[model samples]
Target: MLAGAPSSHMSSSVSTSQGIFPTSRIGSGESPNSGASSFTQPIADMNENDETDLLSISWNQDYGCFAAGTSHGFRIYNCEPCKETFRRDLKSGGFKIVEMLFRCNILALVGAVANSHYPPNKVLIWDDHQSRCIGEFTFRSDVRGVKLRRDRIVVVLEHKIYVYNFTDLKLLHQIETLANPRGLCCLSHHSNTFVLACPGLHKGHVRVEHFGLNVTKLINAHDSQIACFTLTLDGLLLATASVKGTLIRIFNTMDGSRLQEVRRGVDRAEINSIALSPNVQWLAASSDRGTVHVFSLRVRVSGEDSLTQPNAFQGPALFHQNSSSSLDPLISPNTGANPNSSLSFMRGVLPKYFSSEWSFAQFHLPEYTHFIVAFGSQNSVIIVGMDGSFYRCSFDQVHGGEVVQQEYVRFLKFENRPK
Candidate 1:
């Protein structure tokens, strides 16, 4: 049996400071200070008071940037150099959630309850270029989360999820789910594939919808209630963690088949987030245990495997492997193998724990703080904490051990500028 209930929506009431920096593309592997003097003023005021409360933080579809919702408004930051690019401070209200669609000017905003102009039951589609809300969607209950894609807008309520066409805001689909206070839902960002995963009506079950194929598959993802899960950009693979938080299982979304499983630890912990690399070669998970783990994926999507290749059923080479010897450019040949227990060879002779695979690399942080993680370019992991901490670390793919910290910054701190 699981030890506890799944976590609910996370929010922090801590103060934050603002600073401006030059806008640059993420995943460049460049130091934050490499070109400091070229920093430009932010689109919004940088000299605003430092007492703003951080309500939430979410990564963009590509993980190249992140949106931070504050009591004052919301801000977007580039991932690589970790600098604020744009922000909006509203006199009327604050945002509780800000979901970005890549780097475009369109964003889906959910307002904090403290303000009345922007209600918690409404999602406002804001276009930064026009500096106004382009559209809005109202719900009967408070919205739990919002997801944005170029073609669709997903709104998550406590017990339902609504999908809408981006162009005309026409309702496309609606799904009923179990009580999900965390708003646990994920959608494929790939242009060709449209897949959505959310909690099913039963505990420990996941409902996956393949819109293109018009198929729905229910996966018994775990024995306990799911705590966290993530899908690859193509939505071909999914990784899930239960409230137990020790084991993370990966599955093929098309056939509902288990592909791989990795262990986070023996003790129980609250999983904060899970992320899969763009190439579907690596998986990362963060927990309340104050650690982030990266594991290598062994499942290969080959054209020969009819059940595993998403491209065989859909269009384009969604996630196909050329050959057994071929490796993704983002992965090193020596690093893909995760460490297995010596007793693993004894197959079925011992308990599952002895035969499970473990993380290839790990990064430590202060325990008790909520964090979200994502893969950055060049085998680096980007971590953002609810306490306003930002970290960039690289792992020795060849060695498979503790990761090296590349950069660390208190992103939400006050900065003094010359008048």
Candidate 2:
């Protein structure tokens, strides 16, 4: 039996000082960093009876549901009810699921064996409610990621991204990349630019392009593996978490400059997941130590537009300047005429830490938070823990519109997005 009831709370406090940069600091800020924050109570929790590792998860925005892919198959949960709505209903294939995603109402599940030596490849699409396999695709090589675009379904494989037309599943494009790629993120909001991440033995690099043809920016960002990452909806901010250490770095998505580095989970444990709120005002990270941390972020919008140097926060500052001599031409060149150099101008575009005070709320889970995601347009958070537990919690947001009123207004407006 689980020892604790497994509850989660939101506790936050914002404090501003002249600024002290601890080598092991978990969070940072700029001048005039007036912190503000709020918290919420744990709403509900559900458990899946799995002993193996839980791998991937996808949130069904329209249906108010979420699904988690585990070592064997996959488990489905209803975020509204905070319970396991279904278990391993459609995953009958022999391979283990590595990734899962939901577009509209359709669910996609992908997985591969690590040491099997065989090209780890399997794809299955299941009906959400019926929990039945509606479609399946098996490839020769392992699949890295599955990205759903309004116009296409992108499948990331070894060094290549296969783009299939969403309407017909016909191959439309194939993007080639550096060998042994690790991360993939779609930059749809910025003129079809897709961000590709690949970390080497000693450093990390990110590329921005579309159809795998155009190379916009390539910069080395990290030292070890990038554990979890996300880009803001506007493609202005990019957040990356490290697996080698408990550090989260916020970068200017435009040029890949370090904006703020958060060290909160470094000593606690490895962070397994990170979520960027829809408004880009908050960030949530799930740690291996059975805790989910919520941070408030308020971007310092500077009025200056000069390009001589990268724009920085308007408040107290803490900079991570590696020996200026060791910087790479990709990050800092000798001539300074590098177009990529000024890319740091996007630094102050996204909020990193809350302007108000906030504290980390600990959730003693039946297990650790394996994967977590926050819902769009809602103040809801969903966490899937290692002990097969799935928890849902809602926070108090005064700025969030009233649900009853917004729904009525939306229903009455009858305005279509754009035909």
Candidate 3:
């Protein structure tokens, strides 16, 4: 959770949010050297022309900061005080994607923004301390996603994945994929080791490559098609969701063992994103149905074949603890009380909705918006939308009741985004 998050209260009405940076772009007046701000000072009478279309959002929990790509530039904000720490108006047409290198000043940018310093088809590595583009790499096709790890750069293209040496920008290896439109690829690094996972040669299968392409583990995770998948930081485990969207399966990356499964709901819905917490204790999922769910997980880390007992909260931890005693069922259909109650399942199912996983802590959004979910610094849930609205809310382990969410930040006012 962000340090300064206000004490929990039922604040249902989201208030208007003013811009963090003025209209003329950061260089015009809001330079980093600007004097300290006072709370008594009212925002410099706002303006609509000051705000730009927010194209992408990236947050770093380590430093409690996040970055946003706008129509004309990119801006970084500190999470605690919600202050803008860095801003650059490339004057490039626009930035569609901005990938921050954790808390460091290093970042990668690619998108509609095409300029002498940056281009739409290329990823420019920027060092904020220097306030200049340091290194960049271009792709044959439009670049979709860029993942920067300790020593390598992973770039995702429509039908291909590229890995590059971070220091010299040398092309290390490339892997072919099966028409991944969103450019989904995840890299997990730990203890000086790395593993990369993306869609395999087949539709619903997943391929895991350890370090280079020397050793790869292929797991037939689902039947329908992969919606999304995320790996534990150490790359020892992977969680996958298929287009069926109802059930989520966790796999051991080393040997492709199906450890455990969690149910979102029996209703068929589009799964947006799935995140595994640092300790592998919590799993969060978001869907097109306008809800986010967090599930408590239990993993036996003693042995490689140790079973994972998904501790789905129905009433309390005491009741679900018994599920771990037996290894008979790897995936249980009994994700009770938490989500997709039998009644809704009968409806979204017979009516042909995809099954979904129940989040231990579920939050809602306005309908028909594209959103991505992640865990914040303090087990707080962060959900961001493609329309430029983001939220931060923590789950109450005590009540296990309705979740109250506070609006954290807004990049685009409802009226400002182009229709």
User: lDDT: which candidate is best?
Assistant: 1
Please write out the lDDT profile of model 1 over residues 1-419, one tens digit for every residue: 11111224321111111111123333232332322322222343333445677889999987888988988778888888888777666666688989987877678889999866888988877655434455677666889989987788888998888887776665678799999999999998767668899999999999999897788999999999988998776666788999999999988787788888899999999999998775566789999999999999776543222333343112124334555223222233534688899999986999888898999999999899889999888658999998778999998876779988989877675435321
**Residue 157, candidate 2: alpha-carbon lDDT:** 65
Worst 10 residues of 3 by lDDT: 10-19
lDDT of candidate 2 over 1-419, digit per residue (tens): 11111124211111212111112110111121122211111222233222344455665423255556655455555555554544442222223433323323345566546423222465554333332344444555667766654445566665666655544454655556545344354443322334433332333555544233344555456666555666554344566766654666666644566765555442536666666665445567776675566654543212112212321111111122343212111221211110112334554563432221232333344334354545434546656544344556654443322112111000001123220
lDDT of 3 by residue, 1-419 (tens): 11112224311111112211111222123233233211011233222235566677765423256677777676666554445556666444567778776666567778674544456678766554444455656555678888877587788888788787675555677788888987788886543447899989898989899874267988999998898998776566788999877888888777788877778777788888887765455788888888887886654332112223323210111122243222222322333234444555566555432343355667878767777777665567777777766687777754344456755665445474553
Please give the lDDT score at residue 55 for candidate 2: 54
In order, the Cα lDDT scores of the candidates are 0.76, 0.44, 0.63
- The count of backbone overlaps in candidate 1 is 0
How does candidate 1 score on lDDT? Answer: 0.76
Instruction: Please identify which of the two predictions, 1 or 3, would achieve the higher TM-score against the true structure.
Output: 1
Each candidate structure's TM-score, on Cα atoms with residue i matched to residue i, is 0.82, 0.55, 0.73
